[model samples]
Target: MELKVDVLLTSPQERAYHTAKDIAKLQSLNGTAPMLRNCEGLRSRSLGDWEGRLAAEVRGTPSPPDAEPLGDLMQRGSLGQLLPSCYAAQLLPVPLMVEENAVWNGYYRE
Candidate 1:
């Protein structure tokens, strides 16, 4: 009987960067080599004002109606009303999952 091993591959951004570095090092050991292929179509979204802040801190304040959520701010076209260069490019995680207080109760007078 013969034994075989199967391997799975993951193309995470960090993994790709390290792999490229290792390849460069190995090539240098031998001699000058051609440039490694750069990872194309790889984009990282900016954290904006909520970068270093904790979730608990942000949720402590009441969200205003005009206040855009972290997700909308991170998106591209969402900011076009204020900036001309704004455009949607990638997806970003929501910063605040829960709000401390509801912005509107939607109650109407009879």
Candidate 2:
């Protein structure tokens, strides 16, 4: 017996991992398991320290030049180097998962 496969065409954005669980349910009804493909890029911009802090606050203080002017540094470093690296990594077939809590838990497990 020859097995025939049906091609299901769907937009990568519309079928992203954000709706993976939902898509899985729908696919199951149609007798197929939903596979999540990581089309979304890395967790690029945390923008943590630079959120509301002003350059004036840390400029004249003991803070380093990079930390004092984080916005500029981020634009130069992250936008220039980091984002390009992330984009390149996204092109690869393998998926990169960032496990934040796991790293911390391993370091400071009580």
Off by over 4 Å in 2: 1-18, 38-44, 50-110
lDDT (10s digit) by residue, model 1, range 1-110: 42111111112245554554554455566665324332222223334565567878777666545455556644532222212221134221211111112111111111
The segments of candidate 1 whose C-alpha lies over 4 angstroms from its true place after superposition are 1-12, 41-110
Error of 2 at 49 (Å): 2.0
List, in order, the clash count of every candidate structure.
Answer: 3, 0
Q: Model 2, 1-106: lDDT tens per residue?
A: 4211122112234323344445445656767654443322322333355546787765665644334354654453332343344345333222222221111001
Per-model TM-score versus the true fold: 0.24, 0.27
